[model samples]
Target chain A: MSNAISLRGLEKTYANGHQALRGIDLDIKHGEIFALLGPNGAGKSTLIGAVCGLVKATGGSIHIDGHELPRQYREARAKVGLVPQEMVNEGFESVLSSVRFSRGLFGKPPAPKLLEQILRDLSLWNKRDDATMTLSGGMRRRVMIAKALAHEPQVLFLDEPTAGVDVELRRDMWAMVRRLRDRGVTIVLTTHYLEEAEEMADRVGVISDGRLLLVENKTDLMARLGRRQLRLQLQQPLTQLPADLAGFPVELVDQGRELVLDVARDNQGIADFLRRLAANDIDFKDLHTSESSLEDIFVELLRKPA
Target chain B: MNFYSIHAIFRFEMARSVRTLMQSLAAPVLATALYFVVFGSAIGSRMAEIGSIPYGSFIVPGLTLLAVLTQSVSNAAFGIYMPRYSGAIYEILSAPLSPTEIVFGYVGAAVVKSMVLAAAILITARVFVPYEVAHPFWAFFILLLCAVSFSMLGFIVGLCVDGWDKLEVVPSLVITPLTFLGGSFYSLNMLPPTWQTISLFNPVVYLVDAFRWAFFDVTEFNPMVDVAFLLGFLLVCIVIVGQIFRTGYRLQH
Candidate 1:
């Protein structure tokens, strides 16, 4: 399948000489939930802005569904929607008029039913007649989303869509995103929340210092960089490492009350270590295994120089 | 050109004006009425007629021009500037709108507004001072030309300014002072020879003179020169506005 969006050597340099993006090359597959994970000032917003034609890339080109950007910009932009990070709305405009106006801006014929459905879906139908300024911050954000989706874009870019939202509202947004993905819409989201990426993304791309560090399947990335740890709660405390298990990568924890083992090399390594502990006559009442989360891998990746 | 997009933006801007009727429509009309009361009645009774036209009638064109110029610039400037200030400009910039369509929608609404105010002022002038247009068609042509040109200038100012202070500086300080000095109250011929020659350099003077010629058939420069100057200024504004969109200056990151 062709990519929904494609970028080659995309770069941006601000007038002050700050290089925001340094040659980013990426392809987002159709119908996939792609998450771009980055820290602050990591060029995530700039990358999205370049694709949406809100920022002119200093170098390189972008294509949206085979249409070149800023040239065939009308056609290209018509195929995409952007929910910017900024929570901005027409303060004096009614919710219904705001969304309808946005739909018309794309040169699309008015579809009142579709707009109505969108408002209802976002739980904004009841507030349709109210001015945007009268709504809560979360509600205004919903209005922004409704406006973006009013044109029914094939691809949508959500730049930190859940920023400053409450936990319940964030969950609702996540569910809404899942619904959109199920309907075969391509979604590219940037997030500071690692769990959000881990929970929703089919593929994850890590970027830092204006460079894409890696792009991989979410599970594959976790498995490759993640480490597993075993915690054994011993019935008896020990002060020092046993002389017999000198070759094993194990350390005492909780002031000798538990044996912490780094079991990353192989799955069966845990079984082998357990057998060695049995041979040494070590007693344990309980044990549990823990694996490193995507957050850990993300931090580790950012720590390394590109 | 996407007419639908243009209509959408135009309609949205017009709606805002309706919502802010007190500020957008009433304020200017009331101010123009005061000018007629103070400058047309109180001051006109003591001054002699200028160039075969009543002093009260002569200042009608000037006062109308004053209102239209200032209103056109402030209306168009504020129209575009509000979007930028509120961050709603992102929707416009990201939409499939060609820069021309965006400008047309915005400037078109602003022109409509200035013309409405100009018409109201003209009707109000009839109440305070008697006047008749010698070339009614030319009067309308000059009014429209001035409105379109000044609206374009306002559009440029909207794009160039980054703060509220910068936005107010041009219309309040520069344009207002120039219009007053452009013979909005007195004809340039009444000034000393050197001052009259110097006043000719003020672009607003050409606008006022052309408009006055349309109204009373009296002019300091050829009417065609005035028209050409207005068109020339409009073309320059168009070029600068087009460049702004091309470079994504202030609109894009």
Candidate 2:
């Protein structure tokens, strides 16, 4: 099947000469939750803006389900929805009216039931009559989601949907996103929260310095770059590492009270290292194995020289 | 050409106006009524008639123009500016609506508001001073032209300014002074030759003269010249607003 969204050499350089995006080429699959992982000022928002037609691309093109943007913009834009990072709503307008108005903007006939359902799904039905300004921050974020879904868009771009949200709302949002993907809607989200990407993304794309560093299947990316560590708490204070275990990737930490062993996920070196430690009579109070998270991989990726 | 989009924006903006009726509608009407009470009743009885029209009746078109011009700018400017200020403009920007449709919705609503205010001012003026329109069609023509043109100017102003204070500068300082000097209270004929020549450069003068002629069939400049100038100004505003949308000037960034 064709890609849900496609960009070829997409670029954006502000008039002030800030290159927000440079030569970004990406294709998002249908019904997949693609998480764009990037730090602040890494062109995540800029990429989304260009696709949604809010920011003009200085060069290259974007095609939304085979329709070119800004030319066939009406048709192209009809297929996509955006929930911006900023919490902006028509504050004085009721939640229902605001969402209904958004649906109307897409030239859709008023579907009261669909809007009601969306509001219900986002748990905003109770506040449908309330002015958006009266809503709590979390409720307002849900309202933003309802507005984005109002037009029944096939593809949704959520720019940091859970930023500053409480844990409950964040979990609720993640569940809602999973439900959206289950319904065959392609989801592209940009987030600073690595755990969000780790927990929700089907595919993960890392972007840094206006460049797309890598795009890979979530599990594959994790397994390829993820590291495992064995931390040993020494029973007694040790002055330094044992000479016999110098061949292993072990470092004494916590004022020589702990020994840390770094090993690859697929490496069998840990068993041999443990046998060698026993043979050398190294005593430890306890030991625990920890694996590197997506956060660790992301930080490591960004820390590398471009 | 998306009527649904245009209607959505128009209805939403109109609803906002209804919600703030006091500030959006009543305030302008009451202000115009006060102008009539002060300028028409207090001062009219002492002044001589100008061009066979009573002093009270003569200032009616000028006063109405003043209220409509100021309201047109303020209404349209605030309508667009509020969305930008609140960041709600993203919804409009990301929608399927074209630039022209967006402008149509905003400028269209602004025109409706200014027209309503103009009508209210005209009806209120009748309570304080007696007046009749010699050419009702031309009167409405000038009224609409002024409202739409000034609203477009207001749209441009809203796009250009970044803050609330800057929004007020054009309507308060520039438009108010221009309308006062545009002969809203007195005709250019009342001024000396040099001053009349200088007053000719004031664009509001043409609008006031056209509207006054529509009411009293009396004007210093040719009715055709006033109409031409009004259309010209309207066209210019359309071009500038069109360019703003086309280039996504402040709207995009």
Candidate 3:
């Protein structure tokens, strides 16, 4: 099957001559959670806006479920939903009415039972009659999701859905997202929390400076781009580097009491690093290895130009 | 164009607006009552009848339309403005709604709100001046038309405006002045012939004259001519606002 969402050479520029997105090309698969990772002003929102027809694309084209945007907008948009970054709703509105109205906006007939099911899924069933402003921040966020899911679109976009939410709510939201994925909803999310992306996304795309730096499967991307660090505790402290250990790519720490070495992600490099440490007669009290996390890779990607 | 969808949106908007009763309905009605007590009873007691109707009755049509006009415009403008301000418009924009549905939903709800206010003012006016509706059907038709037209106008203004201050500008400077000069408290017949001719230039005059004609069966100007003018104004507003929605002017963003 074709990709659920496809972007080709997408470029967006604001009226003030600020370029938001520059020639972004990407494909998101159906039924998978795709995470777009970026820093502030990196065009993650702009990218989602372009797909959902909120922002006009300066150049290039977008296809939603094989339908072109701004031309086939009605059909393309009907299949997708977006949860924006801000908290927006009528404070006086009931949760049920808000979600029901969202369904009506999609030209769907009033379906009270379906709306009830949605509210139930989001754990907002009890608060259905409550005014939105009376609810807590987390509950309001759930209302946003319930509103987006009212029409049961094929794809959903969560833009920092858990920015300031508490731990329990965040975990609950992730579980709900997983349930949606299980039910065949393709989710595209943009988040500053690399850990969320790392835990949820099947494929990850890093965006920086309005350009896409990389798009790879979570496991493959980590294995291919992931780096490991080996910290060796020295037996004796010294003022300067030892002569024999100079050939190894290592840095001294704790006044020569420890050695920090960056090893390739490959299996052989780790073994070779170990062999070299032994050959150099380096005495270490302890050693620990750590793989580079998504946060580390995300920071690195931002520092490098696309 | 689909009635059901528009109805859903219309109902949603109406519920939202009415929920804020203190600001939307009560405040405007109370203000209109004070206007009647101060302007209608005070000044009306001194002024003589104009065109076979008491000054208070003559002003009633204008005041009614004024209530309808401002409330209509504000209901739609604020309804749209709040969503845009709160960033909730993103939710609506991303939904399956078309601009037409969105516009009509908001404008329709505005008309409903203005009508509710009109009803309240009409009832309150009965308490102050025991005036009866001369041609109740015509009166109802004219009020409905005025409400819908101004509500559509407000919808256009709301979509084009960016900030809160911009939202209040059109209603504050334009609608208020137009209603005052539209002969709400005085008759064009009371003015000099030349000024009377100039008064005809005010689009609101046609609405006020037509509304008064519906109630008293008497008007300073020809009722047929005034109706034609009001109908023309309504058509123009519809066309312009419809074009704004069609072109996505200032709204799609």
Candidate 4:
């Protein structure tokens, strides 16, 4: 089957000459949770807007489910939905009507049952009759999600779904996302929280400076870039490093009282390195290991040349 | 061609109007009714007649056009502007809707509102000034045309501007003043020679002339010319509105 969304040579430059997207080419598989991680002004939102037809790309071809955009726009857009970073529910419209309105806006026939299910899934059924302006911030966000889901879109773009919410709300959002993916809906999201991406993303794409730097399976990205640090506490202080262990990535620290070995998380030479350390007469009273979190890898990736 | 989307947006706008009855409906309707009471009956009754028509009855068509024009422009602006101001317009722009369907929803709702206000004013005028319509169907048709035309202009106004303060500029500073000088309260021939020439430059003059011709079969300008002018104005509004959407002027990122 074809990918859920495909973009090629996508570019967006504002009239003032600020380029928001620079030649983005990507394909998002169906029914996968893809998280786009980027800092502010990293063009994440611009990319989402272009896919959803909210922003016009300066140059590119976009196909959503095999339908080209700005040409077969109606057909292409009908298959996608967007939950923006900002909530827009200040109208006196009730939650139920707003969701129903979104369904109709997508050219869908009125489906009360589906709307009910969406509202219920978002935990907004109880507030269906209340005016949206009267709801709390979290409830309002849920209403946005419900609106996006009301049309039964095949692909959903969530921009910062959990930017500043509490832990419970964040977990609830993750659960809702998983539920949607289980229903065979593709989920593409952008977020500032690396932990959220680590916890929820099946595949991750790191973007910066209007370009995608890397796209990889979450596990593979973690294993490849996540390093392990081995710290050894020496039995006695030494002023110099052991000459026999020169081949290993070992550095003396703590005033020569300890040796720190840096290696890839998937490295298989740790046991050999230990045997060599013993042969070299290096004595350690204790040792411990720590792994790099996603945050660290992300920072290091950004700090290096693009 | 998304009829469902059109219906959805239309119904949403109508529901909002009903929800804010006092601000959207009652206040404007009541103000239009007062014009008929204060100007059409209480004030015009003592004034001299023009062209053998009672002064009270003479002002009905002009005032009706005035009511629809101002109300349609303001209502259309407000209907679309609120969503933009509150940042709810993203859903609208992102939806699978064509420009015609979107305009149909927002402008259609505004036209309906202006018609309701026009109808209310008619009823209110009947309770005060006795009036007759030589071509009531034509009157309704002209009023409908006016509503749709000005409502389209209002739609453009809503999309072209950024702030709330700018939204009111068209209805208040432009439409209201134009309608007032467009022979709404006095006959075009009553103006001084130069002012009458200047009044001809105002577009609202033709709208009032056509509407009054529908009511009394009497027109200050040639009836055919006014009708042609009205159609031309409607075409201009439609073209400008279409351009606004096609270019995504202020509606897109």
Candidate 5:
């Protein structure tokens, strides 16, 4: 089947001569969780806005579920949903009315039962009659999500979904997102939290300076770029490393109390390295191995020259 | 042609107004009622009749049109402006909605609101003084034209201004003063020739005159000119509105 959402050579230059997006090309597949990671002013929001039809792209073509933008906009837009960063609500209007308004704006026939189910899913059914402004900040954000889902869109774009929520709520939201994915809705979210992408995304994309640095499978990316460390607590302190073990990539930490050896995860030869250390009469009281986290990989990727 | 979206926006706006009934519906009606009590009851009892019609009855068309114009501009302005202020505008902008549909949603609501206020004012005026509409069809037409025109003007205001003060500036500083100067309370015939010539420069003068003519059948200007003025004002606002949507003005960036 075709990609759920597609973009080719997307470019946007504001009237002030600021270029927000530079040649962005991406495809989001159905039923997959894709996370876009970028730093401030790196064009992540611009890319999302362009795809959602909020920002007019200067160049490029957007296709949503086989419908092209600016031409088949009605059909294309009908398939997409966006949960923006702002916690805006109709202060005087009830939560239910707000969601209904969103459903209507998307040209959907009113389905009261479906709307109620969405509110229930968001845990907003109890607050349906309350004015939106009376809710807490987290509750307001949930209301935003309900509005996005009101139309039952096929492709959902969530911009910083867990920006300001508490950890428990964040986990709940992640579970909710996974349920949506299981039901076959394509999910694309942009986030500053690497852990969010690490935990939620099936595929990871790193963007910097308005260009996508790389897009790869999450597990493959971590295994390929993630480095491992074998930290051994030495049995006895030594002044320096022995010439015999100089071939190994190692460093002394904890004032020479421990030896840390760098290891490539997929290409690790810990057995040979351990045998060599035994042959050299070097002994360690205890040792442990650790791999680089997604945060590490993110920092390493961004630290590289664009 | 997203009529559903337009209808959704209309319902949303109407609900918003209903939620604030005391402010939106009751306040304007009360404000207009004060005009009837003060001008029609208090002053008209002592003043001479203008053009063989009771001074109280003569002011009906002018005051009714005044309410429509101010309410149209204010309602349309606030309808779109509040969304921007609260950042809820993104939903509609991103929806598969054409610019025309968005305008129809917002401006349509504004016009409906103004017409309702006009009707409320006319009914309230009945309690203070009696009046007759000589050309009822013409009167409704003028009220509609006035509502649609000023509502568009309000839409433009919403799109063009950024700050709340700026939003209120057009309605309070400009439109209200223009209405007052446009003979909403007195006729241009009552003014000297120089002042009368100057009054013609005020667009509200034409609207008020046309509406008054519909009620009293007395006007200083030709009826066609009044119709042309309303149509021309509406055309200009529509063009400007089209330009704003085309360029995305403050709505996009």
Candidate 6:
């Protein structure tokens, strides 16, 4: 089946001469939660904007369910929804009205029951009649979600959807997102919190400096590129490493208090390395192995030369 | 793109305006009445009537339009600009609503507001001056056209303006001066030939003339000129506003 969303050589350069996106190529599959991770000015927001038709692409093309954007915008936009990082609405409007009106914008007929279900799913049913301005930060974030879901689009873009929201809202939003994915809705999320991506996304894409670094399945990425560290607490604080053990990728850490060895997750032989350490007369009081985390991989990706 | 969505926004915006009915309607009505008291009746006591109409009646069109102009522009400008100002536009941008829907929602509310104020002023003016409607249909038409025309113009101004400091530029610098020199208080016919020619250049003059012609069947200029000028102005406003929405001007950035 075709991907729900696709971008080819997408380039966006603002009028101020600042390039926000540079040739980004990505495909978000149907019924998958895809997370795009990047630092500030990493062009994540710009990419989402281009897909939603909020920001015009200077070059390249974006296809939503095979419909070209900004031209077949009505159809292209009809299939996608966006939950922006910001909280904004008609202050005097009730949460229900805001969501209902949003659905109508996509030419969807009025469906109060659907709106109520969206509100309830987001835990906003009780506050449906309250002016949005009166809502708390977390509640307001949920309202944004309800508004986006009003049209029941096949694809949803959540741009840092939980950036400043509370933990409860964040968890609820993640659950709802999973439900959306289960219902065959493709989700593209951009988040600063790598843990969110690690916990929620099936596939992850990293972007930096207006460039996409990599896109890979979460588990495969961890197994393929992740590293493991074997940290040995030394029995003695003696200084240097043995010259015979120099060939191995290891380091004398904490001023010789510990011996730290880097093991490639998929390729390295930890058994041989342990034997070599024993044969080298290095004694350790205790040892433990730690796997590289998503944060570690993220930091490592950023440290790579542009 | 759909009418229901536009209607939803329209209803919400109108409800918002009505929620502060006292501040929005009463304050402006009182302010206009004060202007008539100070600038119209008080000053006119010493001055002769410019035309067959009394000075009080002469200034009514200008004063009423001034209120309409300011209120209409502020209502729309603030409605759109505030959303952007407070970062609420992002929520709007994220929604399924098209730019055209957004524009119409705002402009529709502005038209509604000016209409409300126009009606109020018409009733309020009776206490100050005994006014008659020579062409009631024409009077209502002029009121709606002016409201819609200025509201559209204001929508563009809101889109173009940036910060609060910049916001002051349009109403204070542009609208106020145009209304003042537009012949609200005095007619261009009262000016010398040279001043009259200069006053003819002011677009507000036609609006006031059109209104005067509708009300008392008396005007310093041809009614056709007023209709032509306003229609031309309305078209210009629509084109500019349409372009702004199409380009996403300040909104996208």
- Which residue pairs in candidate 2 have backbone atoms (N, alpha carbon, C) closer than 3 angstroms, thus clashing? none
TM-score of each: 0.95, 0.94, 0.90, 0.95, 0.96, 0.89
Candidate 1's displacement at residue B213, Å, is: 1.7
Task: Note the residue pairs that clash in candidate 6.
Answer: none
- The Cα error of candidate 2 at residue B12, in Å, is 1.4
Query: Which candidate number has the best TM-score?
Result: 5
Candidate number that wins on lDDT, 1 or 6:
1
| Model 2: per-residue Cα lDDT over B112-221, one tens digit each | 98898889889999999999999999999889999999999999999889999999898899889999999989878789999999997888888888999999998788
Model with the higher lDDT, candidate 1 or 5: 1
Q: Write model 5 residue lDDT over B163-228, tens digit each, in one string.
A: 888887887888889989999888788899999889878988888888888998888887779999
Worst-scoring 10-residue span by lDDT in model 6 chain B: B88-97
- Residue lDDT tens for model 2, A125-237: 98899999999999999998999999999999999998999999998999999899999999999999999999999999999989999999999988988989999998887
lDDT by residue for model 5 (A1-306), tens:
788988999999988999888898998888899999998888988998988877889999888888888788888888899999878967888999889999999998999999999899888999999999999999999999999999999999899999989987798799999999999999999999999999999999998988999999999999889889998998988789888878889888888899989987764668878998899888899999998889999999999998
Per-residue lDDT of B111 in model 3: 84
Cα distance off (Å), candidate 6, residue A71 = 0.2
Model 4, residue B182: C-alpha shift (Å)? 1.2
Error of 3 at B32 (Å): 3.9
User: DockQ, per-model, please?
Assistant: 0.76, 0.71, 0.57, 0.77, 0.77, 0.40
Q: Would you list the clashing residue pairs of candidate 5?
A: none
Q: Candidate 2, after superposition: displacement of residue A119 in Å?
A: 1.2
Worst 10 residues of 4 chain A by lDDT: A263-272
Off by over 4 Å in 6: A89-92, A234-285, B36-51, B94-99
When only chain A is evaluated, what TM-score does every model earn?
0.94, 0.94, 0.90, 0.91, 0.94, 0.91
User: Candidate 6 DockQ category?
Assistant: acceptable
Taken over the whole model, the C-alpha lDDT of each candidate is 0.91, 0.91, 0.84, 0.89, 0.89, 0.84
* Model 3 ranges off by over 4 Å: A237-256, A259-282, B2-4, B33-46, B130-134
Model 5 spans with C-alpha error above 4 angstroms: A243-247, A266-268, A275-281
